[model samples]
Target: MTVTERRATTRAAPGPRPAQPPRAVAVGVPRLLYVLALAGLALLTLPVLALLVRADWPGVPAAITSPEALSALGLSLRTALAATALCLLLGVPLAVVLARTPTRAADVVRALVTLPLVLPPTVGGIALLYLLGRRGLVGEQLDLLFGIRIPFTTTAVVIAQAFVALPFLVIALEGALRSAGDRYEVVAATLGAGRWTVLRRITLPLAAPGLVSGTVLCFARALGEFGATALFAGNSAGVTRTMPLAIYTAFNGAGVTQDSAVALSLLLVVVAVVILVLARAWKPGGRG
Candidate 1:
């Protein structure tokens, strides 16, 4: 091409000759917003500080390590672990259905799955009792057919914990699944991957953060369960009286002293903090 024609073409094509202003790197936070945020943080943290201040520090070890406290702690740990497993086994599938299905029925089902979250723990306990008690509809049939009773048993504690905690797993994982989308799953399917393969390899891996977070929440919630477990499982030491129930028993003067209750409460709070810290440090595939 001629030099003049080449020069004209270069002018026609867009040029990056204009000098641009540098962007400001610093951002100013409003004083009012910072004050509000600090207030919100203080609201959450003050109670923890108060509990620490009021606790009998010298008696903590005795209170937590006493045979009765040990029994209750063991029971709480076992039941909470069982409930977390149950949540994962059931909640994962339910979350998948909720996130993947676009139908109105899915919405209804999601709300139903979330019902226990909004319901008072006592109300949930009562509901579970009616549904699984000796005279209950299914409970009666089970008793008539197999002589199996569920209420006030160790199993009942697990059930109560699972009932309340399942929603946490379901909600967290569902939100994760929905946000991650299904394009990758579809692509994998087009490449001859089966549904299970896609889920195990793609969907779940992508949502592992949410799954881990949900599991932590489930475990924490189950460990701290009180009202529902009290009503549905009955506070029978070693069998169903978990840490919360033991704490209650102590606080109410039925068993250990108030110092014991305070110690147990502090222990529970410590465990929750540890779980959260561990969760934050976890890295999926060493990359997350």
Candidate 2:
């Protein structure tokens, strides 16, 4: 191109780029959506705020320090941690299967895996009771062969919590796996890496964030489990009565006070908040 023609073209070019939307517009596009979004945020947060405001702060120390309350808290933490471990051990594999397989059977498996999420907790309790109760299908065999009874025990609480919490872990990890895609795995395999090695070194590391998130969610859910534990585990103090059961007992089960219930509820909320904060602070592939 000639110098003069190039100069003329440069001169005729758009002087400045068109102005983008103003900051306010960028922040608040679709005014209705913005309002609704704020409303949704408020709906989720306000209840917690109210709980904090209405908490019996003076009675908290006494209530939470009570023997019954202490026992329930200890049991809740233990079973919830156990449930989280179970979810991690089992849910990760289930998530990998769901993410890697696309067959109809996989779909059925996925549906069955997620059934507890939509299923009422009470119904899930009944289902677990049928499967693991003393006279239940597999339960009967367990009793006959090994003399193991599952219901109305700490083991039952763990089982109930795990059942309710498994789906959260699986769903989160499966989403992460799907989002990560299989290209990295394929590449690793092409480079002569074995299946197990690739998974342990590449896939799982990539999905660590999801795994952590899912595990936290699982712990929180398991900690708060009520209906299933009530039915399958029974509300026996120091045996199966978790924090939720303790709170319920305080509220409606004879010989307990509302202050105790509020205190326990507040304690649960604080624990959940701490879990969230810890999760957010976690850095994948970084030093703790």
Instruction: Give the residue spans of candidate 1 off by over 4 A.
Output: 1-18, 25-27, 254-256
Task: Put down candidate 2 lDDT per residue, 14-53, tens digits, no spaces.
Answer: 7878888867544447878888999999999998888778
How much lDDT does each candidate structure score? 0.92, 0.92
The true-versus-predicted C-alpha distance at residue 218 of model 1, in Å, is: 1.0
Please give, for residues 1-288, the per-residue lDDT of candidate 1 as tens digits: 999999999989986788889998988899999999999999999999998998889899998899998999899999999999999999999999899999999999999999998899999999998999999878889889999999999999999999999999999999999989999999999999999999999999999989999999989999999999999999898999999999889998733498788898898888889988988898888753
Q: What's the lDDT for candidate 2?
A: 0.92
